[model samples]
Target: MGAPAAAPFPWREVMEFGLGRLGWPPDVFWTASPHEIIAASEAFRTAPAGEAPARGVLDALMRDHPDDSGEAAEA
Candidate 1:
């Protein structure tokens, strides 16, 4: 008999929680690796107090990958 396939990772919940904790929009989470999420979250925490939200990294990911928006290409 063939071995069972592994369950998919809980990407949605993990991403949502990570982005929420960092105070960044969750839109970038789907494309972010766990390491990236961790790094961004850590940076947010370690940033200077009263500084503007550090969303540049996460926001830039979306800006750079415009085609990954899940929209179908026009014929």
Candidate 2:
């Protein structure tokens, strides 16, 4: 018989983080492994909130991704 499912995977907290807080498109979220999602969420939580990004970093971001609207885009 198959081993039982991992308990942590069923936890709603992880699902919400992967789907909601991360704001990943549904397909991307679903495609990511649970460990991948958790690591990203943890990194996001530990990161400093509002501080100026370096000029080069900012410039590169704008050049690579030119979107006018979206909260995530700001950071």
User: Per-residue lDDT of 1-75 in model 1, one digit per residue for the tens?
Assistant: 999999998777666667666556656766777798778767767888786545886567656665756764442
- lDDT (0 to 1) per candidate: 0.69, 0.78
After superposing candidate 2 on the true structure, give the runs of residues whose Cα lies further than 4 Å from its correct spot. Answer: 1-10, 54-75
Candidate 2 structure quality by residue, lDDT tens digits, 1-75: 999977664657766877788888889988998689878978988888887889998889886776765434544
Among the numbered candidates, top TM-score falls to: 2
Give the TM-scores of the predictions, in the order they appear. Answer: 0.35, 0.49
Q: What is the RMSD of candidate 1? A: 13.0
Give per-model CA RMSD.
13.0, 7.6
Candidate 1 clashes between residue pairs 3 or more apart in a chain or in different chains: none
